[model samples]
Target: MSKTINIGLVPFSCVKLAEADFKDRAAVYVVLCMKDNNEWTVLDAGQSCEVNASADAHPRNAMWKTHCPAGNIWIGTYPMPTAGYSKADRFAMERKLRRQYKPPCGKR
Candidate 1:
């Protein structure tokens, strides 16, 4: 069966990938909880679940395991990272954000 785990301390977090295997280089995802506001369910991939093992020809769309031995989990989502071409270009988006928002220098 599949397994899952809870990340410690971090309220809500994520790693946005503009280029992924499923989308046309325009997707955003959060692999961890950083806000602790929106609730999420058990992840389908991790150290406990062997989702990656099923990646053999027409495999499941998601990964379920990590290279590490810890009890971490993995998941994927669609329709995120904003909804524009700038969002797809991470560097350009960040630059635009900074220029438009103009946050305090040295911290973004």
Candidate 2:
């Protein structure tokens, strides 16, 4: 299925896609999700916003990560989120990204 991303506490300007729509696109959506959201991962994003986002929120590759800059996950009205970028926040994110993530098999 395409992946959808959860941008919690959203400002409302972002596109909202249904689960069906997320198929085959999950990777793209996840890569585009806001890097600042505490739930940078799909699971976390959903939990933070109480919304089930796309499963593809977690991609298994490095090229995709570079293509989809985390900052591009646009928010609508509310001021942009900054949690993931702060020193403390970034440290935490680095931990999460490293600990929780298991790259696709053989991805190295």
Candidate 3:
């Protein structure tokens, strides 16, 4: 079973990523939530808009033991190379961030 973590307050800009106004075709995003000591930590991360379309996409409900509402979730969107960005590049970047942050909700 995946570990459950608290998704607390985050920046307003981060919350906007999940919104239609902020969603972009070429982007990578990381979902962040508050961890202990009041520090924001990565809860999950991904690089595709298609995968993010589902209700369980952000925190991946199947992996987590608890549920986090939309208000508790924040996304940090990274603009990708529009001209030549490839799937491999996106995957690599996601792996890099996952390695660094070790977000509990992300794939192992």
Candidate 4:
């Protein structure tokens, strides 16, 4: 079973799952990298209407890989269906998480 983590008080699906699980989902995503010491670092956070597409086209993907050459990168996602959360709501959540985590990449 996939573990869950809290990001800014919200529960998110664990990282390292198949990307197909998140395809076409509207959600907020947290990019993380696990180091050799088993410490996890927050790399970036963002919200997307289509999580898979957003991830595929992410501008910082290269940077993320550079930070974790061992390929320990993971993505945790909190689904926010369009019917339940407005785009503004998702953006607000993303901003809140970014502020709390202060991820190394993106507009931190």
Candidate 5:
């Protein structure tokens, strides 16, 4: 079963896997790092029309790696189909998560 986490009250599916594991769909993506104590830390968050593509080309990929080991990184997604939610809605969700987490790599 997939794990779920709440980012500012919105539930998101999370996995300790790669971007390729996600479908090519519209969603808000959260990058997290599993700390040595087993807690998770938000590394970055964003919205994308095609999550897989966005993740693959994310500008903060190197920054994320620098903060956590590759094996400890997790990807969280809150899928929002275009038919149901607009781009603005997705962006709003992403903003909410960023505000709540204030991920270090998300500077600016």
Candidate 6:
């Protein structure tokens, strides 16, 4: 007999980077993910509303194809960093999450 490990519920958060009142806000944003019950490692990270907007086609979605009954995984964004944050900050956060999660899909 074979045992199956359900991916469990997908977890993610969304942040609206664009603000009509604040022109400085990021039009595109950042996203984070990690496997449930695992150490807090970012399973995947993405920046840019264009990429994020295509949530359904994300590569991470493939990871859950077999593991998750729903054939989907969490792919959401964190609140945009405050005014002090910059594009570099978003990259840095992606790097930090990649370091913590060591997610296979992250850039080398």
lDDT leader: 5
- Candidate 2 versus the native: TM-score? 0.23
lDDT of 6 by residue, 1-108 (tens): 111122223223432212112222332222223245532323456454234344555555565344444322443444354565676766666666566556656474
Residue 26 of candidate 3: its Cα lDDT?
A: 63
Which pairs clash inside model 5? none
Superposed model 4: Cα runs more than 4 Å off: 17-21, 36-38, 53-57
**Candidate 5 C-alpha lDDT tens digits along 23-83:** 7999988888877776888988888898874464577878888888755787889889999
What is candidate 3's TM-score against the reference? 0.60
Task: State each model's CA lDDT, in order.
Answer: 0.29, 0.30, 0.55, 0.78, 0.79, 0.41
Better of 3 and 5 by TM-score: 5
Model 3 global lDDT (CA atoms, 0 to 1): 0.55
Score every model by TM-score.
0.23, 0.23, 0.60, 0.82, 0.82, 0.49
Candidate achieving the largest TM-score: 5
Native-structure RMSD, model 4: 2.4
Tens-digit lDDT track for model 2 on 1-108?
232333332222244222222212111112233355434333112112211243335343344444345533321121123432334443344344334543222221
- Candidate 2, lDDT over the whole model: 0.30
On residues 1-108, what C-alpha lDDT tens digit does candidate 3 reach at each position?
122233222122344324424534666667665444545667776777443344334347444324243344445556565577887777777787788778888684
Report lDDT (Cα) of residue 27, candidate 6: 29
Output the TM-score of candidate 5: 0.82
lDDT of 1 by residue, 3-101 (tens): 222223212223311222333333322232112443443222212111122222213222322321232333343232344434435444334434443
What's the CA error at residue 89 for candidate 6, in Å?
0.3
Lowest-sum lDDT 10-residue window in model 6: 1-10
Q: Between candidates 4 and 5, which one is better according to TM-score?
A: 5
- Which 10 residues in a row give candidate 1 its minimum summed lDDT? 44-53
Separate clash counts for every candidate: 10, 11, 0, 0, 0, 2
